[model samples]
Target: METTRYSVPFSPLQERIAREAPQLSAALNHLLQAMGASDFEKYINSLSALKKVDDHLLLITKKEMYRSVLTGRFLPVIKECFAVKFVRIVSQ
Candidate 1:
């Protein structure tokens, strides 16, 4: 008899974030609250993924358009939530 094998799809960055910084959800919630409106919150939540690396955070996305828009519009706000060196975005 032959058996088929299946693999689980997992994201290392996300896993690391969950394991290393469980408080990230509260930080993200605070960031969202600072955005001050639902639309902005929705847009940010839809566009990127954030991972805490050492003392910094990495924001990544698959779309350059979204990355560009986010980097242009909310980079300052993100920096305010973290140190300037702690926040960054990259296309994945």
Candidate 2:
């Protein structure tokens, strides 16, 4: 008997995210470095761009503390960097 292997394809949202994640990550790293926020730079790896709505980008972090810090302090900078009118950070 021969067994067949199945592969799962990425959904449209996943595909779009996969394509844009690298650029976002790079931009975030650059911004962090430019702002001299080396202490916060490591947290970049913990963030993920979940979705893009009209003029808004949804971001998720592993912890509520990260979400709070990002929303309170970095939201404006992140919005400017991503050229978005609004950014929402959520903890998962």
Q: Of the candidates shown, which would achieve the greatest lDDT relative to the real structure?
A: 1
> What lDDT score is found at residue 91 in candidate 1?
79
lDDT of 1: 0.65
Model 1 TM-score relative to the real fold:
0.61
Once superposed on the true structure, which residue ranges of model 2 sit more than 4 Å away at CA?
A: 1-26, 50-54
- Screening candidate 1 with a backbone cut-off below 3 angstroms (N, C-alpha, C), the clashing residue pairs are none
Question: lDDT at 34 for candidate 1?
Answer: 74
Q: What is the lDDT of candidate 2?
A: 0.63
Cα lDDT, model 1, residue 17: 46
Off by over 4 Å in 1: 1-20, 36-42
Q: Ten-residue segment with the worst summed lDDT in candidate 2?
A: 9-18
